[model samples]
Each structure stands twice: as structure tokens, then as C-alpha cells.
Target: MSRHGTAARLSFYYAALFTAVGAHMPFWPLWLKDKGLGATDIGLIMAATYLTKIMVGPAAGHLVDRHGDRRHPMSLLAAGATLVWLLFSLVDGFGPILAVTVLAVGLWSGIFPLGESLAMMETQRHRLDYGRVRLWGSLTFIASAIATGSLLTRQPSAVMVWVVAAALGLTALACWCLPTSVAAGRGKAPATPLWPLLKHPVFLAFLATTSVGTASHTVYYAFATIHWQAAGIDGDTIGLLWAEGVIAEVVLFAFSGWVVGKLGPGRLLIIATCAGMVRWLGLGMFTAIPALAAFQLLHAATFGCAHLGAMHFIARAVPPTLSARAQGMLSAVAMGAAPGLMSPLAGRLYESLGSSAFFVMTGLSLVGAGLALFLARRWDGGTIV
Candidate 1:
């Protein structure tokens, strides 16, 4: 396929996948409430999904690596997720809902790592810019979140499951449309055992750095709005502040290739962690709109740059046969386990220290920076195995 064609195909997949996420995240809790579930029940369900990702996601990755193909497995998982989501309309009460959710999320969550592995391989082969294509997912997520919120003003929240299911069905179709030629491991065993990679000190350091860097967002993700509101910021302005962070992330992604080429993964990760330190410190200390907005722009470096660094690092430093498993483990730790562990801690800190709680996150960023430095010293631009 031409570069444009390849980018378009991958872009469509991301756009479709995030549409389901955008709708489900903001409104699913409301649906659970409507179904007569309490806050505790909802928390249990959400936590179960995270647990599923931590366990099932990596196992699925290992399977993909063994099978040596991404597209077919991705298609099956997406379609299965849609079918499971459809069960929501028929089942009621906490137990049934939680059971279905665990099953569905276990399947749905695998799609991300698999899709990412495929996209990175294709972009490398085609000499295409990954961020340009990935920006579509971010754009669609924003649109979906806004549109779903708007629609909920008139429609019953009961339609939430159907809406997400529709998006999942579109995602399944998009998976079918992905470039077929990019499968890196067809009928081949992974060159490195998963255990050795897991045990490698440098690899563990890579995980710790990326996980801590990403986890530093826990307090902000959980309570930034409440903090701003307590400071007398209105709903509209708070929304704008949140939008600014995502927009900054998108802008960084739009130019990711150039940024990666200039800095390399290790330096880019170090810069991201350093940016996080400054951002969290400012957010903790200031409530003025000017300071908040200024710090918010660092979302590009803290999240966008960190993510770019991780993706490029895996591409360069992991063997091709192990790529799927590597991406899976990264997703499992950075996105799953770290956030899962930090969320409750973040809530407690926010309760005790209020905005000062952000200082703790700053400390986490500082630790991430140190780990990144350690990783840079140990891994010299080559496969760890």
C-alpha cells in the first residue's frame, strides 16, 4: 500500500476504537447508577476491568506473538466485545453487569496493544509518520465525548450501552480494513523468552520509568476538576482547561516523528519526566487560570512525549518476534497496573492535602526521571536480549 493508504487504514482503526472509549468512559457510570448500582459497586466493576487488562492483556499479547498475526485476532476480539456489550441490555443488577463487563473488557482491552504493534511495524516499513495517523484517534475521542454528553441531555442514559456497542461494531469493521501485509511474526517463535525479558534489570527499569511517569497523572485525572471548582472556577472554564491538555497532546503527536528523530527515546523520556516535575509543582501551588493553563500545555511533554518515547523505544530495542508481547507488557504496566495501584492512593492524598496532594505526584515524576536516567545508562540503543 501507498504511505497515504497505510496511514488512512491505521487512522481509521484508531478513530473507530477510541469512539467506543470516548462514549463509555464518561457515561458508563451513569448507566450503572441508573441500573441501581451504588458507588461501591461501580468502583468494583471499574477495578475489575483494570484487573482484566493487567492479566488478560499480556496473555493475549503472548498469544498474538505465538500466532504471529495481529489482524485476525484483533478482529475476533472486537467482534466478541461488541457481542458481549449487547448483553448489557438484557442483563440487570450488579452481579450480572460486573460479570459481563469483566468478560467484555478482557477481550476489548487486547485490541489496543495489538493495534499499536501493527501500526508501529507498518510505519517503520513505509517511512510514514505515526503521530499524524494517531492524531485521528485523539480527535475522534474528543468529538465522541462531546457528542455523547450532548446527546445524553435529551436521550435517556439507558441508551449508553447501545451507543458503545455501535461504536465497537464500527471498530470491528475497521480492524478488518487494516493493512494485511504488516504481520511481523507469521509462523515463527518469539526470539526471546518472555521470562528473560521480564527479569532483565534494564527492561524492568524501562517499565518503572514509564509506569511512574504515566501514573503521576492519577491525582489530576481523579480530582483536578474538583480542585479547580473549589478554587471558584466555573464549569465552562474547567472544561476548557481539560480541553487544553488534550489539544496540547494532539499537537505534540502531530509532530512526533520529528521530535523522536531529534531526541531519541531515552532523552525524550527524560524530558517528559522533567516536564512532569515542573507541571505537577505548578498545578499544586497555583490556582490562577494563567498558571493552570501554562502548566497544562506540558501535557504534550508529560504524556505525548512519554508515549512517543515508549513506542519508539520498543520498536528499536525489542526483537521483531517479541514485539507484540513487549507492547502488551508495556500497556499492562504503564496503563493498567500503575494507574490501578495509584488511584486509591491519589484519592487519599487529595482528601488530606487538597491541591498540595499534587506535590506527591511531583515526587513520583522525580523518581521517574531518575529511572529514565538509569535506563539511558544501561541500554545502549540495542535489543536487551
Candidate 2:
């Protein structure tokens, strides 16, 4: 495929997948509230998706790794996600909604690691820029977040069900066209056990700060929209707030190569952790538009840089053959266990402390920053050939 063809294909898939995410992340809590679930209930429900990642995400990544034909697993999982979300439009109760969310997220979560593994492979082979390609996802996220936020003004929150369902359906279709299939060594056993890899000091450190840094976002993810609403921000403005943050993230992804070349993944992670501390502290202490807007721009450092740092860590530390497995472990720890554990706590705290819950996140970021700084100082960059 031509370079443009490959980039375009990858960009399309990202757009499709994140279209649902853009809306789902910012407004799903609102939808849940519309359904009559309280803060604690919403927390548990959010946690359930992360919990699914813990139970099933690693195995799913293993399945993708075991087969060389990743396209099938990727497509099927995307299809399953679509099916689950479509069923959501029909359900009304907390139990059914919770059950559906857990199942849908499990199916949905695998697609990201699978896509990342594919992207990293292409980056190695084709000299395509990983950060540049990924920025497309961020760009689409801005569009999705803003569009969905606007829709909420004229349409009922229930309309969100259809939006999510449509996006997943599109995502499943996009999966079929994902970059030409990587060489699938059918029926081959994985050469090494996953546990030994985790025992490496560098790998262990990467996981720790990544998990903690990511966990710190739970307060924002779970409550920011609600908090903004209570503070008299309109829906469209809230959407813009989410979009503005992702725009910062997009900028980081677009220029990550230059940044990574200058500082390497260790420094990048340190920057991410420190930025997170400042961002969350500011978020907790202020609700005024200007303050929130300024802090939202820090999403570049909080989510964008942290993610690039983790990706760079994996690329450097793990064998190329084990990319999918590495992504799974990263997802399970940061995306699965930490967020799953912290999300519910954020909800409990949000209920009791109001916006003050962000203070706890400030502490989380501080710990992550301290740990990442130590790792950066001690661990020289190492790559497995």
C-alpha cells in the first residue's frame, strides 16, 4: 500500500472507534444519571467495565498474539461491541445496563491493544509516524465530543444510545479494512510465558507509574461533566471543554517524535506525571470557566504524553514479537486494575467532598510523578532486538 493509503486506513479506523468514545466518555455518566442511578451506582457501573478488562483483557490480547491473523479477532470483537451497544437501546434497568456495559467494554477493550500492536508493527516496518497516525484519533475525539454535546441540547440524553450504537457499527466496518493483515503464523505456541517478562525491573517500573498516572484521571472522567453542570456550564460548553483538552492531546501526538527524540520516554513520563499533578490540583480548586479551560489544555501532558511514554517504553523494552501481549499487560494494569479500583472511590469521594475529590487525584499524580522521576533517573533506556 502507498504511504497515504496506509495512513488513511489507520486514520479511518481510529475515527470510527473513537467516535463512540468521544461521546461515551463525557456523557455516559449523564445518560446513567438520566436513567436514575445515583453517584455510587454510576461508580460501580463504570468500575465494571474496568473490572472486565482485568478478567478478560489479558486473555483477549493473548488470543490476538497467538494468531497471526489478527483481523478476524479484531473484527469479531468490534462486531460484538456493536451488538452489545445496540442491545443497550432496548434495556432500562441498572442490572441490565451494568451487565451490558461490562460485556461491551470487554469486547471493546481488546480492539485498542490489537490496533496499537498493529500500528507499532507498521511504524517499525513502514517508517510511518505512530504519533502522527494516532493524532487522528484525538482529532476525531474532539469532533465527537463537541457534536454529541450539542446533540444533548436538542435531543434527549436517550439519543446517546443511538449515537453510540451507530459509531460501534461503523467501527466494526472499519476493522475489516485495517492495514493489510500481518503475517499470521497460524497454530504456533507463544514462545515465552508472560510472567517472566513482568519480573523485569524496568518493565515493572513502567507499569507502576503508568497505572498510577492513569488512575489519577478517574476523578475527572467520573465527575467533571457533572461538576461543570452544577457550576452552571452549558452542555455545548462542556463539550468544548472536553474537546479543548483533546486538542492539546492531539498536538502532543502530532509532534511526539521530535519530543521523544529530545527527551526519550523516561523524561516524557516524568513530564506527564508532573503535569498531571498541576492539572488535577487546579481542577479541584476552581470551577470558573477560565481556570477549567486553562487546566484542560494540560490533557496534553496528562493523557497524551503519558500514553506516548508508555508506548515508547513498550517499544523499547519488549520484543517486537510480543507487542500485543505487552499492550494487553499495559492495558490491564493502567486501563484495567487501577482505573477499576479508583473510579468507584472517586465516585464515593465526589459524592461526599464535591469537587474536593480532585484533591485526592492531586495526590495520586504526585505519587506517580515521584515514582516516574526515580525510574527515569535509574533506568537507562534498553531495547530488545
Candidate 3:
């Protein structure tokens, strides 16, 4: 009944969600490397995680809409993901590993957007500060990323998957306690057509910008930890580099309400795209700490701003009944399938051009900025839905 209690529980769930991400996002490739996979193989594996969204995310969203509650499915997915992740310890071959990865990803991919849809509804109903509560997740992300990096300095590669499993275990426990006040469209007319949003010129413009622009970061997401290690950076500093970027993201989330009020989602997205261009290009050319720090600081814009704009855009433009499905679509395009589609190409470029692969990503980010800008100009001034 108390909003504060609900927010704390939500915050804990975020902490668990990102702890899994923080551990896996930066270190999974290293784990793959230790498994005797090449950069290309590693890229393909990472791509699979994103691609699984197409298979699972939208359907999960529809289920949530049908049931009118997110917590039950989230708990089931987290539990399944935990069991599947344990398979990593047993699988040695690439094919087996990919199979397990797909199972894990497809089961778990809908959790975040569903959690977000729940959080957004609470924010509207209870006037909860979405960014402030969300900041706890970022904090843990920093903690887990830094702690896991430190551990891997001496720990075995198996530690990576173990940490991921542990995090998922915690996520399953947290899901039971998440807010369940969200209303479902259950007992209403048949579900809303997602095609209407797809057909909207403005929404399509937004989707195009996100899908194409973020493709550039495929190199960084898939290989930055590996690249920096090859350049002789230690695990501690690599963790710090990851932390530095997320710290900026935390700052952005802390002030997200103000930022959204001032710039709106479209403008924020444009900024994110432009910053992404600078960050990826800089990473390709410079490996020095000062430069790396600068580029990492830009994570605020690249990831932080982009994400803030996305959630806000959904809140403002989409009807509440369609929130989960809309978020699933956003997740699939921006964070899921696009990265899935681009990572292999990034691997090819990385193998052929090494650091020069960043240049290609830079080009993609620029294209995203152009589309985002066009969308911003064409967008109607919208009130929050």
C-alpha cells in the first residue's frame, strides 16, 4: 500500500537485474576467449543474446498484457534462466554453448521491459521518481562490474557464469516481491494492434534512428573488455573504465526527470546518437586513459540519454494498455535484434581492421543522429500518455 515500500522493492529488483548484466556485459567475451573462441565466435555468441528477443520478447509482452500482471512470468523466466545458465559450466563446445545461450536469453529477455512497464505505471500512479529508484540498479551495476572485474583478476573463467547464475537466482527471488498493482487489459476487448504504432511515420522514424544508430556500439559491447586487455589494461582499471561510464549514466538517471522536461525524448535521443558517434570513434583511435575516460564519460549521452528518452517516449506517446508490447518492440529493435544483426559484422570488421572497426560504428551512430533529428523536427508536441 505504501509507495515507498513498493519503490524499495522495485529498486532491489533493479539491483538484481543489473547485477546480472554488469557481470555479463563486460566479462562474458573474456569468458568466451578463455573457452578458446575467437573474436568472431565471441561476437556471434553475444549477438545471440540480442537476437533471442525476436523469439521471446513480444510474446512475453502479450502474455503480461493478457494477464495484467508482470511478476508471475518474470519470476518463472528468472528461475528458468538460472537453471539454463548453469549449463554453461557443463558445455564445452560452441554449438552447445550457443544453444544454452539462446535458451537463457529467450527466457529472460522480456523481464526488463516488463519491469519497466510496471515501474512506469507506478511512477504515474504514485508519483515515484523513476530515475531515483532506477539509480539503485546503476549503482549495483557499478558495484558488480567493478567487483567482478576485480575477482576475475585472480578467479577462473568459470567465475563469470557462476556470478551470472547467482544474480539470476537473486532476480527470481526479487520478482516475487515486485509491485503487482499494474492493471491488465484482461477482460477487455481483443488486444490493441501494434501495427498502428508501426505505421506511424513519427514512431517509425524513432525506431529507425534507434535500430541503426546503436549498431555502431556493437563493437564496444562485443569486444571492449577484450580490446582493452590486449592493450595491456588491467582488470581493475577495465572495471573502473566500465564504472566510469556507468557513473555518468547514473548521474543522468538521477536527473532524468529534469532532463526529459527540458529536452524532451526526441532531443535527448538526438544527443545520445551524436554522443555515441564521438564515443565509438574516439575508442577506435585512442586507448590512452585520458581519452578512454573522456569517451567513457560520454556513456551518459550514448546509453544514458538514449535510454531515458526511450522510456519517456513510450510513456508519452503510447497508451498505457499497450505499454508492455511497445516496450518489447523498442527493446527488440534498439537493444535486441539490431545488436544481434550487427555484432557479426562488427566481428568481421574487428578481425580485418582491428581498432578501425570503430570507424564503421561511428558512421552508424551518425546516421542514427540524422534520423533522430528528422524525427524530432517532425514530432508533434505530445503530453504524457
> RMSD to native for every prediction?
3.0, 1.5, 1.5
Over 1-385, each residue of candidate 2 has an lDDT whose tens digit, in order, gives 7778888888888888889899899999999998989898898888887877875667766876676566678889999988888777788878999988988888988788888877777776778788998898898899999999999989999999889988988899988998755533434766546776778777788889999998999989988999999999999999999999999999888898898889888988999999988999999999999999999999999998898998888888777657788888888888999999988998899999998999999999899998898879767788633
Model 2, position 334: C-alpha lDDT score: 85
The C-alpha TM-scores of every prediction are: 0.87, 0.97, 0.97
Residue 375, candidate 1: C-alpha displacement in angstroms: 1.2
Q: How far off is model 2, as Cα RMSD?
A: 1.5
- Evaluated against the true structure, the overall lDDT of model 2 is 0.86
Clashes of each: 0, 1, 1
Q: After superposition, how far is residue 78 of candidate 1 from its true place, in Å?
A: 1.5
Candidate 3 whole-model C-alpha lDDT, 0 to 1: 0.86
> Candidate 1: worst 10 consecutive residues by lDDT?
181-190
Cα lDDT, all candidates: 0.83, 0.86, 0.86
Tens digits of per-residue lDDT, candidate 1, 1-385, equal 8888999999999999988987776557667767997544555665566667788668878888777668888999999999999999999988899899889998899898999899998998998888888888877776776677667667887888899999999999999999864354456565557887889888898899999997898777656766786798764566567667768888988888788888889998999999999999999999999999999999889988898899988988888777888899987888778876776677667767889989999999999999999998888888887
lDDT of 1 at 316: 88
